[model samples]
Each structure stands twice: as C-alpha cells, then as structure tokens.
Target: MTCDEQTFTMKPGEFQALGTGEIAYVKPMTSDDLTTLFPQAPRMRPGLNLWVLLNADGTPIMLSDSRETALANAAEHQLHTVALH
Candidate 1:
C-alpha cells in the first residue's frame, strides 16, 4: 500500500493529514516524543492510544501500543510504518 493508504489489522489507526504530503502516523505521545509532537498536537485527534507503524518502504502498516512485542512484530515483519500510539 502507499504511504497515504493502509490496512491496519482492520483496526482504527488514525492518520494525521499534514500538508505538503507529510502524513504522520497518529499515536499516543510518549513523554519524549510528546514534548516534540505537542507543538503539532493541535492537528492531532485527541484521546486514543495510537502508534503509527510503517513498512520498510515507508508505507503505513498500523498503529500499536509501545510494547516490545508490538515493536518486535513490526521489526520482524520489516514493516516501514512507525509506531506512534
């Protein structure tokens, strides 16, 4: 799938539509990432444990919890998506 298009385990992983084709995977903000992401928070949807995952090719694969298992799965699969929630 393209970066703008995704199929996330049939689950709802929201995609933040950034202008200039800079689409970001919407995920729950971590303390560190949050500080940085917050500046852009106004553009994000509120209140969801989201983590945008991508493929090696930079296509959105899914959003997931920030757990090792979830990350491992994504890494094993070599998904190009980022885990944002």
Candidate 2:
C-alpha cells in the first residue's frame, strides 16, 4: 500500500510506527534545545558610577544622573534592565 493508505499493526514484540504524516517532523527536545530555541537574556551593563544604562552589547544607550531615570529610559525603549555591580 502507498504511504497514505498504509495500515500499521504492532505485534507483541514489535515497535509501533512513529513518524507518520503530520507527526513525521516531531521529535523530543532536551533542556538545551529549549535554551537554544529561546536564546539567552540580554546582558545589561552599568555605567562607570552606576549613572547610565547600557545595552546588552555594552553600548551606552541612556545617560541619567540617577539610577531610576536610567531604568526608566530602558523601560521606555522596551528593553529589560538588570542591576550590574
């Protein structure tokens, strides 16, 4: 029979067919797989005296006299911020 019309029967010691039509591309994933799929969180950098918000790539994105302002700037630009020591 053709693939589309094939009938599968599993015997007592046999392994059932796994990848059929829609499930042909399905596979199990590990923790690493999920991590790779999502990607690591962006890195945040603090200015020389904790006076600025830097991008993940270490580029200065905002400069403010206070930490709150810097965090606000990051928020306004839709960026996640983390405190860097």
Candidate 3:
C-alpha cells in the first residue's frame, strides 16, 4: 500500500505525521456556535480558567483548560476561553 494506507493503520491516540491540525475556511464564531460546538462543554467556574482551542471563526474546537477550571467547567458545561494564535 501507499504511505497514507500505512499511516491510517495506526490507532486513534497513536502519534501521526505533521499537518494534523488543519481545517477549512469559515466565518468568525459567535455564541450561537457554542451550542453545537461544545455538546459537553466544561463550565469555567469561579476562580477557574478554561482555555479553548478556537477555530477560524472563534469557535472552540477543544474544551480543556487548567485543572482548576476543568471540574467547574465540566459541571456547568460552559464554553469559554478561545485559544490564541
């Protein structure tokens, strides 16, 4: 098989090649996008901070922050903190 076929054989969590974090074009994200974005959003509670991995439209791609905020955000299911470039 080709290189792609070989690489695809790896497990989900297994390390892959470069160019992994690539996405298509889209508009800026808004609060509306949050609903669909973070189905199980981690709510950032008081004294806690949640760092969001945002897309091109400012939508949170990943919902994981410091441990301090994890519990709070997870409990409340809050979608906050957009990652910086």
Candidate 4:
C-alpha cells in the first residue's frame, strides 16, 4: 500500500505503533500556550460596554459589542474562534 492508503486507513492513536520505542519528551503547556490554543474574550474599556477581539496570540485586533461580530471578525481573518465560558 502507498503512504496515502496507509494514512487513510490509520485510526487515532495507531501512529504510536510506528514508534521505535524511544522516549519522547514533551513540554507542558504554559499559560501563554493555552491562551493561543483557545479563544479569549476580554472586556472592553470602561463605558464602551463592548468586547475586544483578540487573536490566538492574545493581541487585540478589533472591538465589538456583540459576540457575533467578534466571531465574524475571526472568520473574516481566516482564524478559528471558540467561546470560553
């Protein structure tokens, strides 16, 4: 079978079987890492009653008073947005 065929038939966690029994070290996720992996909603400045749009890197991009606008902004920017409750 070709690589493509193998890839298509492979199931989750099956890739571990191809390992050579070598110990793989992985770093624990830091707060910054978590922030980037998940979406964040920060309150806007006082008196605006809005939310600031933040990228995965936690950088402010835009501001909107509605959650839909924030999600739309993320979609327009080709980024995935998630709600953090």
RMSD to the true structure for each prediction, in A, is: 13.8, 18.4, 11.7, 13.2
Scored against the true structure, residue 40 in model 1 reaches a CA lDDT of 47
For residues 29-70, what per-residue lDDT tens digits would candidate 3 score against the true structure?
A: 334344456767544344433344543343444544444343
lDDT of 2 at 26: 14
lDDT tens digits, residues 4-73, model 4? Answer: 6643566645654433232211122333333343356342233444445564434456655566676677
Model 4 misplacement above 4 A? 1-46
On TM-score, the candidate that comes out on top is 4
**Clash pairs, model 3 backbone:** 29-57, 42-73, 43-73, 43-78
| CA-lDDT, candidates in order | 0.43, 0.44, 0.41, 0.47
Highest-scoring model, lDDT: 4
- Models 1 onward score TM values of 0.31, 0.39, 0.28, 0.41
Residues 11-85, candidate 1: write the lDDT tens digits.
Answer: 223332222123223334433353243344333444545554444333444445564545665556653334343
TM accuracy, model 3 = 0.28
Cα lDDT for residue 71, candidate 3: 35
Q: How many clashes would you count in candidate 3?
A: 4
The TM-score, computed over Cα atoms with residue i paired to residue i, of candidate 2 is 0.39
Task: Please rank every candidate by TM-score, starting with the best.
Answer: 4, 2, 1, 3
Candidate 2 C-alpha lDDT tens digits along 1-85: 6778978777743343322111211122333333233355233342223354555544445444466776666667666655445
Better of 1 and 2 by TM-score: 2
* Regions of candidate 1 where Cα sits further than 4 Å from its true position: 1-45, 78-85
Report the CA-based lDDT of candidate 4 relative to the real structure: 0.47
Instruction: Give the Å shift of residue 38 in candidate 1.
Output: 21
